[model samples]
Target chain A: MAMSSALQNGLIQLQLFEEYSWVFNLLFYVIFVVFIFYGQRIQMYVMLREVEGSLFKLKYIKDEGRKIAIETIKEIGKPQTDPAVRVDRFLEYFTIGPQSLDPAGVVWKLEHILDIRDVRFKDEVKLMAPATDDTQAHNLENTLEAAMALNFIYKIIRHFYLLGKKTLSLYIIMQIQMILPLIMREAEAYASALKAFAYGQPIGDGAGALVAAKLMRGHEIRKVPKDCVVATVPIEGRTTFVMKAEGPGGNVGKIGDAIKTVIDENEGKIATIIMIDAAMKLEGEEVGEVAEGVGAAIGGPGVDQFKIEESILKHHIPINAVIVREDIGDAVSPMRKEIFESADKAIERIKQLMLERTKEGDKVIIAGVGNSIGIGQ
Target chain B: MSKTQSNATTRISSFVLLIIFLTLALSLTALILATTFFGQGNEIIAGYLLLIGFIGVALSTYVLFQTRRRMLRLRIEIPPIVTTIECRKCGFKSVREFQRGDYIFKEGEPCQKCNEKMLITAIYREVKDKEKTA
Candidate 1:
């Protein structure tokens, strides 16, 4: 009986010892196993959480962009239905570029696709905002397009993020994290563009259009092909035929077609095609600084530039480009004072080029290449 | 729920969590200091206190970072636009707030100096400090 009592006491002492030390031991073992077996997983989860936070911010920016679009449309368009639904649908619209496997007629095919997309987008805008005039309709289209861009960015980022989370792929998460800042910068740019487009303000992209407008102002304007306007203005005793995308509306007119038409009409007698455009400035470069170069100087899907190059090569004509430098942010956002002032500088450069390169009474084609949003001819 | 409302709720909850974590970190730090300086040779207690204190501080920092980021995201503001008009004949210039229909090269009211027609020569926003990229 005494031995039995002693055994019971020993068992009680063992129980008490375990009760005191079990928590620390369990913690130590759990931590050791987690660090050893699931360290990468824990790291991935932490990064995922971080990415999720950024994703949330992106969503907010996108939603704010959409809200601005809907409100602007409702205020200006006075649409019969709630534009929110139509705007949401329009935001999801996509365009598929033509295949280039054969590479023979891809440019024309791409241009045809772009034409159809443009018409469809305009028709969608008109259907949604039937009460708007032509100018208002164009502005609304631009605003919605910016909103659509934001939505696309958000969706794409969210796609990679969710895909990463689902597969627990550190590489995917790292890729997204590395490029997140650039993506966000672009998204913010589009967000700012919404305000400019909605209000029909001139953007830095319109610097080229502004230069043309200033030169072509008070001249007898004529319609060229594809929503473009041309006027004959005398610059330094030379007869200058200046052309630009018709404006006070948001349009990057069919510049390639217009240039082709103008060249065809003149029968290859054009001396020099002076193109002015807003060029993306390098870092540390001053905004609105005008630099002269030789090329097409147009920024898009290479369609218009191709056409210009083809026509120039056929006629063996000299093409000079005067670019007004602007940051990516400035290109789409409302114009800054520096950019607005650059128009005169661009004009002076063009006049100088004309004097040095062409003879008196030579026919010079000065094409201002940009989206003439709020600049009139 | 709407995205805005959801964002508001998330922001509020994050703020509350930040406060809680900060309070916890402060209390843990204080306890650690007290235990270190005045615990009178209780080494085990001090060791545990130090570990707990660091963990608490780390959590608080994480929460603080998140809350600050959300606040920054919420602070976006739209820029205001301005118009600069100048007369071609007299070179007189005037500045005004931008209207809806304003465009570059569009003729505005007559000039104040010479009664010549003033033209909308510029429409732009004043440069902000944040936009200056050195």
Candidate 2:
């Protein structure tokens, strides 16, 4: 009976950890870390699968906004694009609106493409609130991205710390350790940006778009693209077409195509093309600071810039620009009070500049060139 | 920017969490009473009771931290200021907190740098932690 009891005691005692001397523990940790990396990759892959999953739960946009969001997410999830391209595509969608099938910010196109009924689309848009603004709209998207990235990185770290018994192979651990600081910095940036988004403040970059939306005052406006709209107003007797991305939806509709369509309909009679957008300021420049300049003063992949420039050149028209200065962070998050307030100032500036440059009866094109995500025309 | 509204799951879990906390507290108390038998010759039972108490402490601590963190996150406030004043002729501007009377196109002070008219052209707030915005 005593021998049997001793045998049971031996069975209960776990010496395997000490016997293997932690090598096995280290291997397990490495494997866990590797598993975490793969898990993140797999999760990301599954999120884009017809976009019917938990990732949608993380999305903050809903209803009509969801309509735009689903299209944007699907585009970003295109498996064929490279990682860099995917990021670029995401930025483009958030800032510029959907491309390819619908280059112009046309409402009917979205309705047809998404197979959304016209009456249903209208009702969904009616549910949109102007207060949602461009910065606030994109901030939600950034928050989701930051959260996903942070969770992935955190899981890797936790797996290693837990499974590896807090120690591992020197070389690989050293490599991970070295890269961790840099990764940490990137993570820090994401964290701050997420906080900025949470508060619904405008990033420094979104000032131009906000000002453009201010120019629209946009009740009863017409749709041009995803989250983009346009309105025609006669300024000083000149037929002016004001275009901007639809507000409260984080859509930067295709401003270039919108301009092209107006120019074509006007039969190249656009005398002066005035573009207003937010510009990144040099150090010492103030946020919400407005400036007037020559040329387009529009920033993007040059697709829209080229289209606007070509159309202007074809019409032999003079192009003027007004720019709002802001930092990169403020450009894409929520619309700040200053940026929102700057809209009034930007509107006044645009009016003065257009009056100064164009004669009465001139067909002038005033385009608010920026991501119109939260900024409605 | 958009408002961050809490999901339904968070609200439901909050009630569930309170129940869990109370139950765990009672369980830890019972475990401690069992541990008093350590000197009564039931040492193995006392040891197991002590282990359960330790686990309860760890779980309770985690739950407490999680609750506090989530509560703090929900108390997001609105940012005080949103506009920036800038110069049209030259690069001069100032940022200030929002006032009730503030609106677009309202003229403010003259430019500090070039003496041009400094108009309130852009309204935006610099985002920082604890600074809420609309």
- A174-201: candidate 2 lDDT, tens digit per residue: 4444465455444434444454433333
Give chain B TM-scores in order.
Answer: 0.64, 0.53
Please give the DockQ score of every candidate, comma-separated: 0.44, 0.14
Fraction of true A-B contacts recovered by candidate 1: 0.74
lDDT of 2 by residue, B13-49 (tens): 6676787688688668858777677656455556667
- For model 1 chain A, where is the 10-residue window of minimal lDDT? A9-18
Candidate 1 residues A111-146, lDDT tens each?
Answer: 999989999999998888888998888899999999
Distance from true location, Cα of B63 in model 1, Å: 3.5
lDDT (tens digit, per residue) of candidate 1 on B1-134: 00223345245475577586776868577666857644564444455567667777777777677676777665445677888899889888888888888888888798888998889978888777776843
Residue pairs clashing in model 1 are: none
The CAPRI quality class of candidate 2 comes to incorrect
Task: Please list the residue runs of candidate 1 whose C-alpha ends up more than 4 Å from where it truly belongs after superposition.
Answer: A1-39, B1-10, B14-62, B88-91, B110-117
